[model samples]
Target: MSSQTLNKIPLISLVGPPNSGKTTLFNYLSGKKFKTVNYPGSTVEYSISKILSKHAVNADILDSPGIISLIPSSPDEQLSVNTLYSHPKFGKPDIVAVTVDVSQLSRHLYLVKQLLESNFKVVVVLTMTDVLYKKGFDISENKLSSILNCKVVRVNGKTGKGIDSLLTVLKESLNEIEKDSAASLIKADKHHKTKLLESYSEIEKIEKEVLFETDQKSTNGKIDIQKINESIVVLNSAPKFLKADETSLKIDKFILHKFWGLIIFFLIMALTFTSIFWLAAPLMDLVNDGFSFLSENAFTLLGEGLIADLIANGLISGLGSVLVFLPQILILFLILGLLEDSGYLARGAMLIDKPLSKIGLNGKSFVPLLSGFACAIPAMMATRTITNKRERFLTIFIIPLMSCSARLPVYALLIAFLIPQETPWIGGLLLAAIYVFSITSSIIIAAIVNKFSNRLVKEKDNTSFILELPAYRMPKPMRVIQETIKNGKQYVVKAGPVILFLSLLIWILTTFPNYDPVVPVSPDVSPEQTEILKSNERMSTSYAAYLGKFIEPVMAPLGLDWRVGVSLIATFAAREVFVSSMALIFKITEEGDDMQNSILNSMREAKIGDSDQKLFTTATTAGLIVFFVFALQCLSTVAIAKKETGSWRIPVLQVVVFTALAYVFAFVTVNGLRAFGVN
Candidate 1:
């Protein structure tokens, strides 16, 4: 917003401790789908949107990152602290909403107390009140408000229990807090840093008076709560000895068990990947046939020209290759969103924290690393949660090694050449092995980098891995669906156009300088054979072929010809483009439903340069698979890495190193497999 715009409307800044349901309340108030994963550091950056609500107020809401104290330790915290101090560009907020999880009120209110003492209008927004009984406590919101000298409201994010009341109070408070254009947010005297541990006593003393014991039937034989939002009463009447009421604690026991947790984590992943194939297969076929029908109609209508070929092969065919994977993308995001909201995502991180730390990585790296499997761009963004600069950079460097969904199309196409589609389970197993290998290789690389980093960087990065685990809750249906659709739209709107442009570029290069079918009539050659000769002659002399042959020398060691070599270069624009490039290169214009199968068969029958040897032997196919798994191909991922790290040097070096290593690995694989008599 401009300075004039900021001067007229009021700004309300939402600040709270991590995982305190601050973003959820922002979602309910603003009606935007900013992701709310059930862990700390989910909101690495702040979000701003016009207040979309029923209250008759013209204002903007700035959702800042969670901060424990006014003093900051990490980059993510510093960014939020910058806005709290009212950066000149963002302007000052009229009132600050400090969200606190009632279950962990004693720990969360430290920030609220600090904001109050800093001479800012503070409203204590209470979330997760449903889990009060689970935590063996109940809180009086009115008492806490009076004690803290601030307004308090209890709201349930899932149910929208008291959202209206919260908004109404915020509008009133906006007027009461006098407007200020002061450059500095904190007008009090300058101070020294007192660690969060020092404030524990004062925070607990205030908590004990307002928060009552939930284990007892009645606190001193009297039970009553003030009428703020009517959510202060005890939720569960059961007498419980455990910390969390019952179900969550029991569920946590097995999922968090040392031995069982590993099994459960792997089982969950196995089920997730199985569902991606079994569930999305039919949807993929539907999309494929739909595009095929469109292409056929377009071919008939346009009727044999460059426009027709561009529409049928370049546009429809190329888009179909990538869009066929949309179902799998949506399913992947849906399952991930469910995992995040159900709180199992955080536990999975905790369960594997020890093993990750053994490799000089933090548990905080788990979320970002898991996100890397979807797409490296967002995965690198998720690394903001890592507090230490050294660790965060290490996490970003290895993220590209994780096989993202963009590689799925490439993997699926090549695996068909190795394993028959008849025994699909074997192909599935092979696919699973690729994912496992990618993760294992990444861990090994991280270990080596960590060792070298420790020796090079003299200053010790002693930042501890601190995370607040959210209690297990049922994943909300609407939230999961919304997140899935949002991500699906993002992939289509952002990556779709790039894929189309590159596909068209490949088509133009392959189709130009047409070779006229002026072959001399031979008695032995049939009409079909003559037509095939004409098509092959035209393709061999095309621009793409010349480019492919130029790179053929480099690819010769892997037993690959110009056709396969060209596709390896094309996929770097975006990994899914490999299938489209191969489709266009092989002239598989009619992709009815077996587009991939057609490509696979053509690749099987393909011959090496002037030789009878098959191009796609087992050794060559395995080499290509390894090359794709380890290569840093996507430009978007590289751009994000630079933006996140604020250095072009790192991303440029990352691309060079991974690409070179991939070539060496592929070279080793092909020769080693050939030595084993596999071909």
Candidate 2:
């Protein structure tokens, strides 16, 4: 065959097993920083981008999902394997870059051998060499490359070590493929039909060949060790990163113990959840102050007209309320990201797997469930990583009960009134109790749903959990901050507009029919008192109040009145709006520390309709807390569920089922508590 330069740009496909740092390498080559998740199936779809590394030849690179073999075991694996062939849009790949984790070199090379036999140009990229080396095992790149009949390069994706060398090899491979472009493209067009090597003993033999010990003793390719050592590695790679890994091994030992592990996991979770409250308070206040400043400026600039009031109260305040959650969102993901990068999260998943399995989910569902504590929108997106459709749908269905950060304000406000401020620990304890109750209820409900769903729908769900833990490494501060900021932006982008529109709608609903900008106030009162009275009068006569009165009878069963009905309606757009709606109901514009105290005082003094008794009774507040825990209040979550499931039936079912459950549980709680004479 005559050699010729191709007219089209060369294509390269990146393939690797999960947690092999493949996405990190892809980010380097493509000049695109896609999130590198530590768990499997995060890269559920392929990402294509232009080759931007100066050392590499100009080409288009496709980063595919992690796969163990050419023969697919799951949907995501099939997507990865399919891209090795020539595509109508992608053309033929000049080279397939297989990222081989040196720690598990032998197993990774099986895929390399398969590609080599298929007559495709394959380059074995040795990553995590340091990870293996720290475990006292090192590889001979020349020895391994000679056996595989392909060029091999070791690269550190995080440090940019050996990346240029790897890129140069890709350049050479691209040139070699160009020599026989026509024939190569023809070969690439056909799919891989026969299965690849499946023999474990054969792989183990090869594992022994190229691996050596730093201290002159080697476990070879697979890290075989004493029972304790094997247990250490199994938990997460207990690398000899000095005495630190030794400490990790000891700590992991205790954490994996049957009794201590539960205590440890709960402590870790409590720390994570509590950080969302205390750690985010100062930053949340800053965000609130920032928005309040903007709202004031908007009102000042436009003067006291409907437009100014709408822009300030409806638009700015609306966005401010939802966006105030940005700090908590960032903090939550930051802590979780650090935990993931440190390898502890893998153990956390494993620890939780037993209970989850009882409810028909595996460790894979933990990430999404944990993420739901931040927001259901991203939590729902995280479900894509779950390969099983049923598990993903079920995870999404139960996510609302996780009590996301959106409900934090509602909880904080209600808890403030429910528990006296003088006894702060009681409030804290009660708050913690609510979260505990919610999580427990979710587990129970999930088990019930799983049982009933199995009877109604018969689908083959035989997929078992396969988790490969990465070596524990110190989390990079930059990576944690970057991921947190990325997720914060996503939260804002997803929920911002929805909040804005609904805020405008709610303002309109509470302002009109008569549409009066001003209401009569007592001339003898102070300015603040006059403004408060006018605000109260305006709300009392507004269209929202009329609707609230209409729905009051339905809500009364749970001991809630017209005001709570209006607030609940407002939160449907975004759950965080419940706080803002409550603030409006109480004649407050913001939920900062100073204003929160004022709102609490107002709520304490509040009466139901013409009655002299308090409205926010302890029993009613407890019922409200329980209601928020189970209710599908966030429409954004519903929309995302619709998007992920591709069915209206599921999302509708989620809303109906959760709302009914919330009503029932809340009614029971309120009545039950009153029967116990707690109030």
Candidate 3:
């Protein structure tokens, strides 16, 4: 092969087990700041960046989703495995870079062995050498390299230590392969029929040759023990000597204590909810005022016409309803990112493992379930860590019930309206209660699903939960802030367009058919009342009102009128759109009033037909909260669920089952509360 042909844009892939600092190395090599965290399954999707290495020009580096083995299990693992050979878009990578945690060498080497057997040009990057030294194990890269017949480089991904040497080794290895093209081609040909049993035997041989126990207490204290491939081995000075850091052990003792841990967990969660309200309040108010100003000024400039209504009522007011909650969304992710980056999230998962197992999941499932509170899309993707197919699907099924941040706008709006802001503590407690209720409901539903799924699928449960708790470290503030902003931006990018489209559709539906009121304009009636009457007359014959009436029969049982029914339909696009839809509808009804004032006052004063009874009573608000909690309203979530599961049936079933549960629970809650004289 010619040098020119061998130098064709080199593609390098980074692959590793979860939380092994694979992405950190990718950032170092590519000089890009992709998000990294202490927990597993953080990289739900792959990232590609142009490599900036001096030795390797025109190189494109791909950071694939983390995987435990080449034998694919979850969607993420499958993607990683597929990327190694012939990715449809990325093509086959010229070289594979495997990151192995030296502290957990025995476990990490399993994937490396598989990669070697597959005949790919592989380089093993040993991460966490300092961590390995802390654990009292000294690893020799040269020894491991000789045993595995591959190049090994040790580097600290965070500090950029030894990165230049690794790149140099990669360039040397590529040149060596190019020189021995005939042998390389021959080795590639043999990989097609590589035997797994043979590979496993070779891995066992390599493990014995390169790994050793360090003990100083007794004569010949390093005596060999039975080979344990599944569990991690912690080297110590003696058989009984504890290897864990004293500080971490002490912290875990209190934080992982069952009773205390549960209490502390709830307290932390309560604080998080409280902070969302307290921290985001001023920013939310600013956003609200800004949008209100835009709406008023645009109305004045455009004058009374469809264009003004479109710009002010349809666009500004609708977008404002969702935008006002962006600060809260940012805060939620910021808090979660801190928890995850501090390595406490894994300990929390460990604390909840027993309870989760009773519901047919384990600590691994808890991370994804916890993430569902931020967003179900990524939460669903985070289930890639659950190797068991049954447990992964079950976790995905209940994630939407966890009350994601998208529901924050609706919850905050309704809760504020329902409970006075003067009693903020009460509102905060109510908000926390909603989250607690969501978790409790998810557990119950998961338990029910587990019972039935066992009878339906009948697969043996061979997968065991094994969680590796990372060393505690301070979270990088810049990274956390960047990730939080990225998440908030994603919400805008994904839901913004849909909300704008729906707002316009709703505006048109309520605006047209040109119904001039048959009754003469009474001189005694105020202009606001006249506009309200005109709106009522027009909406009575408009398409949106027709949709509302069509769905009202179903919604009326939950104490919602046709207007609320219209908003509910719009929520199918996104849970937050419920607020925006209501804002637009109410703004259209009461013209010439401040948009903010019109929405709040209109909702408060709204009443049922032929009666003065308010529509948004305590019972109605509670029902709506319950409905939003259970309903799988986000279309993006459904699409992702379908894509992940590779079947439309699961997504369809999710929607049908969750929507029905929402309606039934809402109906029962509303009627039951009213019957108890709570309304």
Of candidate 1, the 10-residue stretch with the lowest lDDT total is 233-242
Candidate 1 residue 464 Cα shift, in angstroms, is 2.0
TM-score of each: 0.88, 0.83, 0.84
Q: Per-residue lDDT of 1-679 in model 2, one digit per residue for the tens?
A: 2211342777788988877888778877866444332222256567788788565478878887888766666556766777766544675567889999887776677777667767777899999887676666688888878877789998986798998898889888877765754344323223333432344445555566677657423445554557436545543432221222354677777878889989999999989998887898678778776877787677679976679878877887788787878788888889888887778787888888787888877677898898888888767766665666667677877888897888877787788787766897787788778889999999998888888766523567774777766666788777567657767775677688888778778878776764554755566778766666667778888889999999999988887789989989888767888866666667654334354666777788889888886788889989998888888998778887898777787789888999999889999999999999976
For 1-679, candidate 3 gives per-residue lDDT tens digits of 3422554676778899877888778867776434332223377777777777554655778888878778776666777777766666666667789999876666688788877767777899999877666544567788999887889998986688899889888788767755765223222222344565566566655655565544322234553343221113422222222255556778877787868888988788778777876898778778877887888888789887678877887888778866876787778778888987788888877777788888887677877876777677778878887778777788888889887877877887788778875796787778879988988888898899888877424557775767777767778787677667767877677667876777777778777766455545878999877777776777677778877888888877888888899889888877777876787666533445544456778788889755888888999999999999899998989998898777886788889999999999999999999999988
Best by lDDT: 1
Which residue pairs collide, candidate 3? none
lDDT (Cα) of model 1: 0.77
Worst 10 residues of 2 by lDDT: 235-244
Per-residue error for 460 in candidate 1, Å, reads 1.9
> 495 in model 2: Cα distance from truth in Å?
2.1
TM-score of 1: 0.88
Candidate 1: which stretches are off by over 4 Å? 1-7, 33-41, 87-89, 133-138, 177-184, 187-200, 212-247, 455-459, 513-534, 590-593
Backbone clash total for model 3 is: 0
Of candidates 3 and 1, the better by lDDT: 1
